[model samples]
Target chain A: MPLAATLSSVPVVIDEEKCIAHKGCTVCVDVCPLDVLAIDMLKGKAFMKYDECWYCMPCETDCPTDAVRVSIPYLLR
Target chain B: MKTVEWSVDILVVGGGTAGPMAAVKAKERNPQLKVMLLEKANVKRSGAISMGMDGLNNAVVPGFATPEQYVKEITTANDGVVNQATVYAYAQHSYRTIQELDRWGVKFEKDETGDYAMRKVHHIGTYVLPMPEGHHMKKVLYRQLKQKRVEVTNRVIATRVLLDENGAAAGVMGFDCRSGDFIVIRAKAVILCCGAAGRLGLPTSGYLFGTYENPTNAGDGYAMAYHAGAELENLECYQINPLIKDYNGPSCAYVTGPFGGYTANNKGERFIECDYWSGQMMMEFYNELQSGNGPVFLKMNHLAEETIATIENILHTNERPSRGRFHEGRGTDYREKMVEMHISEIGFCSGHSASGVWVNEKGETSVKGLYAAGDMAAVPHNYMLGAFTYGWFCGENAADYIAETYPAGAKPVIDQTQIDLERARVEAPLLRTDGLPPAQVEYKLRRLVNDYLQPPKVTRKMEIGLERIQQVRADMEHMVAGNPHELMRAMEVYHIADCAEMAARASLFRKESRWGLYHYRVDYPQRNDAEWFVHCHVRKGADGEMEHLKRAVEPYIVELDDTEKSAYDRLRVKREPAIA
Candidate 1:
């Protein structure tokens, strides 16, 4: 399997309760290097494509609430 | 994940009063060293000296009192529960911090006698002291930073400290506010100077009080340190300012100076005369209001006259004031401004808690490479009044330690995954679909804590408050932020929930109450010095649960003079007469 395809199998969960509406954070929008994830302000959350997410946990660690949870494929028992 | 790298000798987070001084002092100690500062808010706006307050505490003036006297005063106020060694260190080095600010061109107010004017405010007993001129202090510090060529990254929030293989602080991980990019700063030493969390559902007026100024001080440093295995002290001891200005408008505290005013409830009864310690009286008033005697208004003798005069003055002069037409010469302009500024209003005053991450005499936490300063780090017996002093000591010590341990040219390793993780975490809020509005969550959280978890209300309905907060937390799980701004607001409310839970948990753990105003327990009416005289430590466990640890109180050895001793005794006796 390709590296991008392997990475895309990881699960990304967002905790909506922790999101504060400050238009400053666009990590998901910018860090997707692949531009797979975009911020939807109307929903006040991030939208990701199942095939597009690279399984990078940048969103999980940078979140102030530790709200984003990432589970790597195969690593999740 | 892509990696980005930068190196510095010293990294100071939250460049308020102490961060700048720490950076300046580090450069002063060794000019060849590189010092960097990162602040979440605009560096010009937060921290101890941020508001242009015209005075610092009395650690500067010569011959008025010694550092020993200052330590004695603090320990007395804290009821001997303070860490005496840390208190001494802060008091002793306070003069040096003030002098350093002055050397850096920070100006202070002068007296008619040509010496630095001193005030007897906020000190134990009758000790008078010199303070920096408030507004000019900021200008001086900023100019010094510019002159020193210190690298400052403003509007950047530090999310976590970088831990090396040895579990020592290697540097910090943060997100840039503007670009939404992750910036990993590698430094030999990291100083956590993030100010205390203030935005937690504390009842604050709608006006332009300082509490509303910096919403970013959500105890980030404290939470980060706790998660990293640092001990936090006295998390239950929250400071309540007695007088908040107008609920409808902006105002500062009027109780700081000698204001000739009386506090009355809705029944027009003078409640404050019963106890000089206004914190107690205010809490009692809240209880009365909860018991159905409230919607109380503080009738300021000066304010009433000032309002009438301002109305007449505006009417006579044809100069339309922004607020409204004012009367001429009917009242004191100072009084009118006081009301306009929201200085005399009474509400639940919450900003920086005097409690936080526990540190030793050297400002070292349990973690080796980690150090805390400002409102974020917890030092016993030090109140917000002494924040600059404590910040100075902690910052200076951290800088010196970093300089001695690691010289220039020390390469720090950058983790690309860590950067990626951090960025994703910060932006998660912006990805939610459907849930509660950020503002509504904020309102509900604040209302819950204010109504139930506040000291006065805490005693009556703590269990109910806890249940409500838990339910609220569950409900919060359904909250969604549609945009980056909304996500930031969501993060703020989430932070508040974390803080409120910690505070309520701490309050519930300590069954017996001590420290008259700080932890007031109506049920456990007396100060059980024998059983309850220990500092409470809160930390997150391996299971991600908050574990509580009780450490013995450090003995205060400072001897007071006969007169001072008498005064101290009198103040303690006067604190809680109703319960006694």
Candidate 2:
């Protein structure tokens, strides 16, 4: 199994109240260097694309609000 | 611990005009010698050429004037504060530097008479000729460096200079931006042509903004040299630009030509018209803004509806005579301009701080084996024109000295402990639990420095500002960084704190105001030239406390004719009225 698949099974939780619209958290947009999490301005938060997530944690680390939470699978836990 | 070691005869810290020329001179002196250049940013994007300004102030080609007349003009413009020896050296070598640039394949804009055009642009002193294709100058220098087989390491930030037991420069350690790898380069001689530290809390000058493109210039080389025990001169002297269109934006001044703009208070009254001196004009504007007439905008009178039409017509017709297209392209549409065309900030002709590291005639710092050139070194009384000229002289002299004193093929040991400490320091922000995000920290830092820590404000609330900055520095200590990019941001904050502290210390030490632009104390409004004409020097003590020392101004030897001195004095008296 690919690392993406193994990591995809984990839950991705985002706190919506903290997003500042800085656009620094767009980890999954087209032309993005990393495609871990796609940002939807309409949704006012980031949507996890589990299959393409590089597990780079750029979105989590760069989030100004500390709103991003990434949980790995049971073996890592 | 693993280490990577490299060796070179001469290591140039900056790849700007001075750096490349210095390396080339070293190679010319010895063909078999090895030269290495390290740049914090890309070489093409360094110095005055990066912003496409061809040449700074120089009296190269005679234009209805002689070199002696040009020297008097410079001294008069500088208000008799220029170092005569440095100015004379520049006057003599100005033609040679220009000729070298021509040989390097750089082109200059010519007049209709088929001769190179010269403008009376005031940079160093009175006249500075513009280079139309100065960007090509950077490219030509880079190509020459390649031809000389000089090794260049781009995107490498030189953290510190390594000194041997005798306090001589042995090598340098830097971190690579792309790979996030640390590099240790051993060199017998090091030339610091790294330019001025831009991170100090001051308004952006055209030269500074034109170089960095962004606000990331945190005075890295200044801090590095100061830490290595170099005597820093004139830390309080900062240049203020009268024509910053937007205070919060990335854009800088646009060329408004000879017809200058007017600065107004919030009440829409022209304030600068009351004062003729450029420094005084800026000081009055700053005072107005502080006294609740703020968010002030510079208005240009020439940018009227007629000007917009002229510009639009020029752009539409692609006319050569109309410089309007240049203005409009920079978003300077007269019709839809936010302010009336009557009010515009004067662009292009502005002053930079005429102070830096104190160096003698040979550009040698107090520390042996470590030399400073360009804006980073202080040659008393010299401005940008002298800076460029002294840059060449120092670069050539340092290169030759290195070639003679230190031979090629010498390798030095790497300090692994120092490398680990630097890495840990950079990574500390990442490990923090965090009181604030990096962006928030950056915002707070900029606001505190710009609003409260600047010159006009420093007079009123300096003690409070210093205390606030101390607290802010403590807050920055808690800033977290998780990635390499974030680590760089954290390091920027550290560097800014270092520069801000030095500036504040320098500000506190100078009891009386000497230079109108620098050391502006609201409490002490008078220029106490009798008591405070001495140069201010700041150095960090063993306990990390800043030590302040006052030294007498170095005397200048000027062999000026009676007519020249009389004309110079007359111009000095008239300077106040001309700017007013």
In lDDT terms, which candidate is top?
1
lDDT of 1 by residue, B1-580 (tens): 2234567877888777667766766666667768888876555444544444434534435655677877776665565677788778877766676666666665655668866556554335333333323444556777877877788877666777887766677788766544555578887777787766666544344211124323456667776787667777777776454332222211122222323344445554444433223333345545544554454444444555655453334222211111121111223244433332111221111223347778876778888768777666666434333455655555566667766666665554555676567666666655556667766667777777767776643555878887888888887766675544344455556666767777787887888865555677777767687877888888888898888988997766676565653343342222345664
Best by DockQ: 2
Summed backbone clashes in each candidate are 68, 14
Cα RMSD over interface residues, candidate 2:
19.8
- Model 1: residues with Cα > 4 Å off, grouped in runs: A1-77, B1-5, B122-124, B127-133, B204-213, B247-353, B380-385, B407-421, B457-460, B470-483, B560-580
Error of 1 at B268 (Å): 9.3
- Residue B43 of candidate 1: its Cα lDDT? 57
Alpha-carbon DockQ of candidate 2 = 0.03
